[model samples]
Target: MDTTKKLPLEMVYHWESSSPDSLYMTQPIGHGKVVEYTWGRAVNEARRMAAYLKSLNLPEKSRIGLISKNCAHWIMTDWAIWMAGHVSVPLYPTLNADTVNYILNHAECDVLFVGKLDDWDMMKPGVPESVRCISYPLSPSNNFETWDDIVAKYPPLEGRVERDPDEMATIVYTSGSTGRPKGVMLSFNNMAFAAAGGIETLGVGPSERMLSYLPLAHVFERTFVELGSLYSGFQLYFAESLDTFVQDLQRARPTLFLSVPRLWVKFQHGVLQKLPKEKLERLLKIPVLNKVIKKKVLKGLGLDKVKLAGSGSAPLSNDVLDWYRNLGLELLEGYGMSENFAYSHMNKPGRTRTGYVGESLPGVETKISEQGEVLVKSPASMMGYYKDDEKSREAFTEDGFLKTGDKGEIDEMGRLKLTGRIKEIFKTSKGKYIAPAPIENKLMSHAAIEMVCVSGANQTQPHALVVLGEEIRPKAADEAFRKELEESFKSLIKDINKTVDPHEQLAFITVVSDEWSIENSFLTPTLKLKRNVVEDAYQARVDSWYAKKQPVIWQ
Candidate 1:
């Protein structure tokens, strides 16, 4: 509620120090009780870890590889790496072994930090024989040192590293949905500026609680969860696993929640499944019934408690937004990229439009270029791509604005309505340009549709490949049921076609029984559908399905 002023980093730390006995970071996985690390405890551990890292005698600004899920120790290790005057290279824990090796060797890490060892055997092959890997919380491994031992051996430093705000702090490797991952170099000031801006805009205070499940390796989570929590003195709880996500959510009951669009789509589908399509449609037809339906659905998702919920990393459909807005939860869809520290534009709760990504964050400027590309200038923009000066040059304009790659137009209200990606646009035979993301988002927002891709590179018009939702798989599996599902998609596509130009209209829709998955290379770790790969894999089948001039089911 204190919109008048924003707290500084020193002030945030001072608040934390004042509550030395208050909980800082917590996890319930191994600890008998919810593992609580206080402000004093965290400071001590971070200092000792820093001292231990400093004793390694690595070169100044040496790259340190961090491969782990979200955990309290990850933060401590990051601080230690920073205090030792090294640059942190955060890798997605779900990345393949070969990719992991490529990133590890690419960074040429002097040391590696391990937490939540999921694929130890696969990951071990990639680690250089000479590179020392220290696992957090100590495990039975001759090659690794324990955190407790490292802290006990080295004393905490009297002062933290006097970092130059402009100096590189971390090199975050993107999930590389299209190609080999490139590390995006970011500075302390880049991250710190975004943290301050987000805290100010979102009103994050010491009283807020945040649950950490999204991979901290991603800049989106890193900025919002790691830096935001650290600078705001907020209590952070790490979820044990995907299986216990709901349990962890109930336990934390966070005030502020951030999620990707895929999760929001899933939540929307869950509500629809309970009410069913015909019944919900019938209910919505009546004004009084619509209000009652909205109230019941919002309360069921446990999102009723959320003061502010955000969807980002991918665009969310208007239908999903409307579903949540009907409830009391003010679900805002934000738009940003890793190069921008993942905080650029967000829809403020009270002020928002249906299709817009909302206004720019504080101290951030947004403009649409002549080519319709969204360009942003912000203090939080990354320094440059790591070791890729040419690529870095291409990412920014001559005037120092960061090209967002997304094509969009901003309204007078300052809301950014995304049209499509510059590269993702397809040209039909009629010479008309079709943006597939918006169309794909519409199909995906359907209750029965889990994932959808719209493409028609060399065709007359575009078509869609849709994956059926998990809950309705059995019902949709039967031939009779398949026909019903197909008809539903046909009607949905017809409606979608009405909204787009003739060349951009979908000619047919193909239903895929199996969902596209991250592990299968169809999606990125952040759950963004890898458009190229998905289209390539289903291209032949798509052609065959479309040739039928009817909805076709693919098992």
Candidate 2:
């Protein structure tokens, strides 16, 4: 109903208007103790934290760093920073000490709030001398002021600090797979618009429950999990850790869930582990048995409670989507980048597409350029690259549309199927253009596959680098497993070749180690494979493949 641009102040107003006793955060406090906060209490804490931040007398729009995992106090502190007229710079809790230093120094942060101090000791060497540090509400060894103490010392201001919608609100540092970190400046309206769009498309409401496990430092999680909750008045719950994700899932039984493709793929693998592919296929052939099994699977996965489930940040395999559909859960694919607040395109509930990233959300416009790159015009688009006007100029069109680096085609149903990254499409010496994503997706469709990247840069034919599923192991240290992998790759190649032109057919397959991961920088935080990195790592043997013109199996 709010047509005007939004600010964090508006959220406080809405929270105050809601039922005071509604649950806000449900998380284990300490030593397996569960604690919950009500909407009224959350708002009050945010107000007090806002007041404490303002008491520091920092300049308007001063950058404040928040180093924390996903938790109740993290969101409160973020809103407090903006409410106090400062910009928030969130750092991932699990980041390497070097990255933490890089982000803090790059943002020139004036203050740092440390949450979950277990890793803070390792990160302390990175904090600049100029910045002040404080711990969260519970650090008992506390020499520094705790969040609660600070709030008590400085109560909420008489009135809110009004802000313009276009003003810079947060500086999010993106550690893209191939490049150094870049600070992305997003306006208050960018986040607000994204949350609004999600609410409209998904019908988020006060009655809905959300489980917040993704890193809050990531733009996707900050916008979809945090801001969207504020907009819809949904109850948000945080997982204690990866070990407790399933327990947290059962506790929350979230009505809406969002994840990257990797998790969905893992879920599919988990299901296939219990029920073999051929057995599942045969069961589906039986009418009554199929329905009963599907219902059971959905209920077991906690997806039966999901009114809406979406995948984004990376391309999801159609195999995973089809498997979920077999279990009666319609998992939709979404497409977005950090620069766009991660909600440009989404498969709206009831009107959905499996492989495509669905239609543009309400109030957003998208088009494919002559070069097949996606361009978007949306309220949720980033203001610009922080403190980098030259980079910003090149990132946007002359008319101001955000040029997404993705290549895609719009189907008759208005859904967009991403083919590949424009920069990632490889050109061979044979004057053939190859898109790797389609082939990579096909390879990952196997239950025993985990990660894959395709490359043919400056070569005669394309090749694929793959990782086996977590449960799958080589048949033997000998050539047995390698031979089985080769046969599997051949079968996959045959199927993928049928779906594409000759230029795009994969020529070689290499089964990579199962060690590639987001934390290891092999992938982006969103679990997207970095093709440039993968290709560079395997550059030594690349030319020999073209000379041989035969698929070489590498273990």
Q: Please give, for residues 142-248, the per-residue lDDT of candidate 1 as tens digits.
A: 45787878888888876534677788889989888799988999888888888878888887788998888888999888888888886677889888777677667
TM-score of each model, in listed order: 0.93, 0.94
Worst 10 residues of 2 by lDDT: 1-10
Q: Which segments of candidate 1 are over 4 A away from where they belong?
A: 1-16, 30-33, 138-143, 277-300, 553-555
Instruction: Kindly give the stretch of ten consecutive residues in candidate 1 with the minimal lDDT sum.
Output: 3-12
lDDT of each: 0.80, 0.79
Error of 1 at 129 (Å): 1.9
Name the TM-score of candidate 1. Answer: 0.93
